[model samples]
Target: MSGCMSSSDESDVSACNHEDQGDASPMEIPADDLATSDEDEEASNPPPTKKQKTLESKKPKTPSQIKKSTVKVGGKCSSTNCSKKALQGGHCFEHGGGYKCSEEGCTKQAKVRGKCVPHSGGNRCTQPDCTKLARLKGLCIAHGGANVCSFQNCTKTVQSKGKCIDHGGGKKCSKRGCHNQVVSDKLCFEHGGGN
Candidate 1:
């Protein structure tokens, strides 16, 4: 057989002269010949340019380098004692971090001024004459706070209803026509009641 092979199977074969054989089976070149051809191709090609060699030698930046690049130069937490990076509104997530209550002396986190719920700080009663903290309804206990007795004109604190035990709010005397409150017995102290 002639050393020349068909073009279809050996289109990449630059070192061989293969004549076109229409619809012929592909020729299998020896492994040693293939290696020699590869070596010859490498020798013929020019070496990489200086810039290409430099780019190939360069490595990707390390994690520390990336972190340093992202670090802020002068940015810091708003809190005087804090040294951490500021995440929002010039403050760290730990010290005065989130949105704070607009009320004076209140450090609670709040979305709006009206809805600022006190977490640790106490809110003053809405009553102008009161200086105590408000428990509910914007007023202290003396100024119509929550959890008061449900009885009319009753200002005492409550166990359940708005009325104190003395005002028939809790368990009352079992005796007929007796409105006195009871202790542990079904009757009051005046009605032979004792626990």
Candidate 2:
């Protein structure tokens, strides 16, 4: 025959002239050539069935797509004794590594609206006549956001060990014969302690 052959006989007998016959039935393809041609045809054309489309979509992504989908995990800040994650520079916000206040001559880290808390930035306390920054539930630390001193008749915030700074709960100066609170470098300001 001039065209490809299609048979429904019991014996394995088939002939397909793919070059001459542009539109031949898949059943006319020889058994040996079907495996390779089937894969190539599927890859070149979109899947016809919904199940086939879903299966095709589940294939592994290309290298470029994989790179775009990956998330970059941040490392710890490089500042001394700081355990927070690094943001912009090598240090944490408290160690002068984040966005600084936009106001001139201000070096404090910006918490909201590109300005520090003292410069009318960040969420304010919900309590009346209180302008301090909110710590929890829109309330400042002084307004029940934090724990108070355990000492009797004391309303100050707890500094350390359930006690306020006045109750000797804060870090003290490292110098001999000094009981003052540490300002920097484990020493009081009076002992030339400034960062």
Candidate 3:
């Protein structure tokens, strides 16, 4: 009878110890080794960084800002070359960054648009007779390229009624002996009369 009572007492003590241990888990720690919390981590990591904020583009690094460089007044890559200025985005034709011409002597930047001038209607080249790019209509101003039509070169200027020679003024075609309605665009009947 005494042995049975002692066994009951020992079992009770063992069950109580187990229940206490189950309530308090071993892994339930509150980040004891973490010297600081999230607030401190953010404070030390920083945001956009010092130099990253100065760049102008929405994207972090623009092509012009590459190689950590700047341009000079007389045309030279101010980063380290000390020679003639390369293009701000990449290398211009003269500086030799490997881009083909839109046409002859046209050193406009070559984008997917595929011209030295990007979107100037191919007028990116500032030279007087160097209308090399066809940005708007696949051609430039000179050499019978995009007629612009707002100005007065070909009677094909078709904005208003009196605008195009063919549709309005009945001007003769500038080509040899073909006298049709010379509208803002200079194509014959078979060509898109540009009416």
Candidate 4:
């Protein structure tokens, strides 16, 4: 018991020595080495800035602006303009609500006794008695035929003034005492028709 008491005292003396050594000041550090000052800290990492968003500029719109858009239909024209319609490859009589030449791709409309500004590939004659494609030529054979001569089957060259008679560049045809070149109301001499 006396030896145990001496060893315990020795251990307590070593613990006291350790406590005294702990009293020494901790290792000194320079003040400059510590993190301080917003600017000095920010030198390593800058603060983020707010980003601005961009937008595209556009023109303002109105009802009139929208109405200006062209439409394909609505309106009509008079008979005088009929020929003009024909030359524009012919049009329905109404002609898109009185808007002449307003067809989507056409530039010509009714003008001067069935005339329109000429365009390529669109002149077709639609005269009542004629059916030929109305082009640079004004009239077709049947209309031209009747205008030049009054008699039926008048196979005569058109004279100085579109006449068909002995005095007008062509000799009258005399087929078996017939009065006209073609069969006609002007009958043969036997029928008492020719004067």
Using TM-score as the measure, the top candidate is 2
Candidate 3 lDDT over 1-195, as tens digits, reads: 334445657776555655655664444544554656666888888888666753432222223334533432223333344343344433333443323435545545455444445443534434465646543444444534433345455534454544554444446555666655443356443333422
* lDDT (Cα, 0-100) at 22 in candidate 1: 35
* Weakest 10 consecutive residues of candidate 2 by summed lDDT: 64-73
Q: Estimate each model's TM-score.
A: 0.26, 0.38, 0.24, 0.17
For candidate 1, give the lDDT.
0.55
For model 2, the superposed segments whose C-alpha errors exceed 4 Å read 1-100, 103-113, 118-121
Candidate number with the higher lDDT (1 or 2): 2
Q: What's model 4's lDDT at 79?
A: 27
Q: Give one clash count per candidate, in the order shown.
A: 6, 0, 13, 9
Relative to the true structure, candidate 1 reaches a TM of 0.26
Rank the candidate models, highest lDDT first.
2, 1, 3, 4
Clashing pairs in 4: 74-96, 74-97, 75-94, 75-96, 75-97, 76-94, 76-98, 124-134, 125-134
Provide the lowest-lDDT 10-residue window in model 4. 52-61
Model 2 lDDT, residue 108, Cα: 69
Candidate 4 residue 124 Cα shift, in angstroms, is 3.9
Q: Summarize candidate 4's per-residue lDDT along 33-106 as a digit string, tens digits.
A: 56465558889776554331111101222212222213222111122434222112122333322223323455
Off by over 4 Å in 1: 1-124, 147-169, 192-195
Candidate 2: residue pairs that collide: none
- Worst ten in a row by lDDT for model 1: 60-69
Q: What's model 1's lDDT at 81? A: 63
CA displacement after TM-score superposition, residue 27 of candidate 2 (Å): 68
